[model samples]
Target: MKTISIFTQKGGVTKTTSTINISGVLAELGYKVLVIDFDTQCHLSLGYDVDKETEYNVEEFLNSVEPIRYAERGKHQNVSVISGKLKLSTKSLKRDSLKKPLKKIEKDFDFCLIDCPPKPINDDLGFGEIAIFASDYIISPVDYDAFTLDGLTTLIITLDELQQREKLTAQYLGFFFAKVEENTKDFKEAYRELSESEISSLLFKSYVRKNAFIRTSINTGESAVFLKPFSPVSMDYRKLTDELLMKIKIDAK
Candidate 1:
């Protein structure tokens, strides 16, 4: 499987939402997808509505004793998930702890999407390092704010450090804006600056406009794409997924 990690250090970004929606769209396209919720809050698990009924969570896999299991036929056909738990937040972890366990499960799917925890919650590296190390490609959601640059910088720095100190096999597929406000000048400026910067080539074409239905659809145990495929929010996710797929194709060249 091609493992994709949706991660960023900044909180309140669309990490979980983007992870589920992107994977949902992939499932719609007939790709076998597996989602791994590596966060303590377990929002991805709850979004999939697999939080309570699943027999295995990331905690069990990370422990390396229990065999990895999945919540089958999750919200969509061809989509399955490994849920997340609160215990992962406090659990002590080594640098490559998740890598081996993920290897055991990922090969079964066409793609594996990991919903990473926020940086400040666990520790200096958090589950971020392990997740990144295990991924083949990464898609970080950037917000249209001053902090966006800082967050991207920190992410790139971390990846560089991991490549130097540990073994990281992932490459950036590109980062896209989430919950965007297209009409605002500030938002436009942030986009422009990023597009003109040194890492300008890493920017994506998708603009995920601010949509209230996103959270509402997700909270009700359905991805926005599945809940309202024709809604503006779902349409936005489709664009993001399209751009992501295009990027991946070009990268394969």
Candidate 2:
């Protein structure tokens, strides 16, 4: 099984949205996909409308004395999800109980996408380190803002440090611009500046445009691909997924 972690140190960058959409795209393309909501907020779980009925949250898998099965086979199709609850973050419970359950889940799913928490929580409990160690690739979502560049830099540095300290070998998949508004001057400027920088190669050419339909789809517990496959936002995600598949193929070689 191949593991990918959708992560960012900063919040409000659509990390959970990216995870849910990407998983949906992959599943639509006939891949067996499992999304693990590692964040304490449980937004990914809620986005799929699996929050309340989910029997086993991430916390249960970690804290339970016996081997836990957290994944809920989706009522729809090939997609499955391991939900996360708000209480998972209360005592830093998710961070403490991740490793074993993750290993088990990795064995079952063909592709595992982890929706990681924000940077502060990751750093406080060294969750990022564990995630980096386990994943085959790391996908970071960055906004079209000046400060996001700084966050990207910190992410790169953290990965480098993890590589040095742990001899980690995960491939860096680089950044995807999320919720971008290219018509706006500030957004255009930020994109232009990033394009001209040294990190340009790491920035994905396909970016997600800010779209209400996409948000509405998530809110309604349906994927953008399912709700509006022909929309520009859906097309962008398809492109991003194509790029990701290419990277995964190259890495597997």
Which has the greatest TM-score?
1
Q: Candidate 2 at 179: error in angstroms? A: 0.7
Instruction: Give each model a TM-score.
Output: 0.91, 0.88
Clash count per candidate: 0, 0
lDDT of 2 by residue, 13-42 (tens): 988888888887888888888777777677
| Model 2 misplacement above 4 A | 52-54, 63-76, 89-97, 121-123
What are the runs in model 1 whose C-alpha is more than 4 Å off?
Answer: 52-54, 64-67, 73-75, 89-92, 120-125
* Top candidate (lDDT): 1
**CA error at residue 143 for candidate 2, angstroms:** 0.7
Q: How close is candidate 2 to the true structure, as a TM-score?
A: 0.88
Q: Report the poorest 10 consecutive residues by lDDT, candidate 1.
A: 120-129
Q: Relative to the unseen true structure, what is the C-alpha lDDT of residue 190 in candidate 2, on a scale of 0 to 100?
A: 79
List pairs with backbone clashes in candidate 2. Answer: none
Candidate 1's residue-wise lDDT over 1-253, tens digit each?
8888898888879899999888878988889998888888888888878864446887777877565677875355788888888665634777678788877776688999899877832346578767887788988888877777787887777776666766677887778988888999988998888888988888987878899998797778777887788988789888888888888788778
- Against the hidden true structure, what lDDT does model 2 obtain? 0.76
What is the TM-score (0 to 1) of candidate 1? Answer: 0.91
Question: Which residue pairs collide, candidate 1?
Answer: none
> What is the lDDT of every predicted structure here?
0.81, 0.76
